[model samples]
Target: MKNVYIETYGCALNKADTFIMETLLEKEGYKFVEKPEDADIIILNTCVVRLETEERMKQRIKELNKFSSNKKFIVAGCMSSAEPATVLSIAPNASLVGPQAVERILEVIKSSERKIILDGDKASVTPRLFEGKIAIIPLADGCAGNCSFCITKLARRKLRSYPLREIVESAKYAVLNGAKEIELTGQDTAAYGLDLGGTIRLPDVVSKVAEIDGDFMIRIGMMTPEQAMRILDDLIEVLKNPKVYKFIHLPVQSGDDRVLKLMNRKYTVDEYRQIVTEIRNKIPFVNITTDIIIGHPGEDEEAFNNTILLMKELRFERVHLAMYSIRPNTKSASLPQIPDSIKKKRMHIANKVYEDVAYSVHNEYVGTISRVITTELGRKGSVIGRTINYIPVVIKNENAQLGKWYNVKITEASFYDLRGVLV
Candidate 1:
């Protein structure tokens, strides 16, 4: 196909997959189009994170199937590999490619008959998701965690850390390409470098990139508690660099020890909090964001209350809350599931608790002047800027320029963000 149209979904890893597809097709003289109506090849990079997400992906696939008679349509990404039968049942005529098989996109595009390439890891493809604004570097693929509820582990099979030099070079390439923000991401960032000999770890990677001689800032991605504990001292050292954003994302999942044990999480609540305490003691301005699953199986009422208490004690800058929904073939799926009503109730309570703490923390920013980097345009005609600590500040003016720093006076605050006006 001469023209390709790709719609990416899911996490940064999937976006990086689309970037690989774009880079490969461009080398063969293929043109990318904005809309599917104007393209010869249509590809939908699907996500299967939640049952609801799969349903949404199915709807999108059906809409794109109408173009299959004229266009060479394909279904790619996590769902292609994890739920191959489900995808084929919906669009049997379309070619299928897995998340790991991104490099073979051109092969599927060239074949006339239905092609399916969903075997294993294709380490040859190094994703450079530089969309002119930010450059996302996938330091590795897969993870070393054995969490009971994660279906992503099935889609992305193993821990394959890319070479340290190559990963560092990708960061250099991004900065040279005018990207102001460099994100070091992987399935489990703290677990990086274990597949490579034990010499290099994530701290080594971040330190090398920080020395790349650029005005860019680095943001490290999510780290499982067990792995983050392994490299806390070293991680803290690299994060001290001015090039790194004063932020950390640690997905503790649940706060109760009973729930954590049933979920097969390696770290305890105290262990997770110690990591948070250390980061706060060393870098007080660092914003810590976390994830919490409200209603996992085996979470008793006492366990649920413990989580609420933890939230009040920690008061994370942002809490990504989710209701536990069982995914097929996962360890937790076989266990007794909490009722949907219970999960929904827990999610609502957790959200209310989250908003209470979030608003209180954000109110501290009001009536203060701070410098922020204008990053993206908000959906409401304002420009979104972020402080050094990564707290989003909405400069309520449409004419603000991006990629530049502006001094703003904080006028108001919400649980979501800070609203400011140019000083």
Candidate 2:
């Protein structure tokens, strides 16, 4: 069997895609390798979320080019989808595949071709899980919405959902293999099943997975506000599932309606607030987290202030804040960009606010006891693990194994993590 090494970058969805691709290659008589040096085939699963991420991918491609003279190098994922032409320019002899082309990975690996663009013609293929305590079931591919700053449209062109039965079987297989977490991932998870023949919906998928008797937790991936509003009742029911983790990672780009409109997000500030309010109202103990981009092209002080105010009001348990950067094909890239100084200042403010919000939320857990699924043993005497609500807790336990479950009592809290005692 030919040796293959796959490297992944970007979100959990991308990581899941890499796993799927690796599975396909392995079935085609390829042996998986940990390092690129010993492999006959090297695949870099790319990301294009930020300019920096794309640049890093470029650097990697260039470095990988050194060995390309002797081995088969493949560039797959978002960077390949968004900038196939540029990728060709950098590694003039490599093959490429977009997010939509899972069926073609085996063919690409078998062939000795250059500048191959294997995109579209979507089909359902059950992905292979190689390792770990978590099983990522990609229920859907691509995204339905066109947020102005997003370049995902270049690669993840259409939203396609897998058959509900297929996804459920995949979850069962993973659980049988000792996976304690089953994460449902996609570009827009809530947009699942729209392209399928029926109106099955995302919650239906989650409920089905939860029905499987096990000690596993289900984590739902990113969802747009539009989808959330459409299936509010079903979503609420899914959140109430005991097998499902009590944490949601939602992206609310900005707080001002005008900025949201410019980004073509299709939802108003009030609409977003209502969705979040409903989620909180129904799942009171749920840990709500979000992604916030500071200093978009037209964000002035007032718009920035609105974001800060809303974040303070929501008290999001966690926030991934990024300073906006222009990408070539995105609609927002052509607009008059924000000044660097102003953007930096806004980012600083947003970071401070996010830290404060995180601290406040953490403080509430200081006296509470929660069950932790141990993931690692810390460098010191502490054991680190994640709670069902997705909170990272470090407990002083010297004997806990990596994949064991234990109850922990919160002893202290910080802005970034929590300290607990194993119960």
lDDT top scorer: 1
Q: What is the C-alpha lDDT profile of model 1 across 143-209, one tens digit per residue?
A: 8887899888878888877788777877888888777778888888999888777689999989898
Which candidate number maximizes TM-score?
Answer: 2
Candidate 2 scores a C-alpha RMSD against the true structure in Å of: 1.4
Give the per-residue lDDT of model 2 (tens digit) for 181-271.
Answer: 7889888888888888547999999999999977878889888888878888889898888888888888898999999998989888899
State the local distance difference test value for candidate 2: 0.86
* Residue 45 shift from truth in candidate 1, angstroms: 0.7
What value does the lDDT take at residue 202 in candidate 2?
92
- Local error of candidate 2 at residue 196 (angstroms): 1.1
TM-score of each: 0.96, 0.97
- The positional error of residue 360 in candidate 1, measured at the CA in angstroms, is 0.8
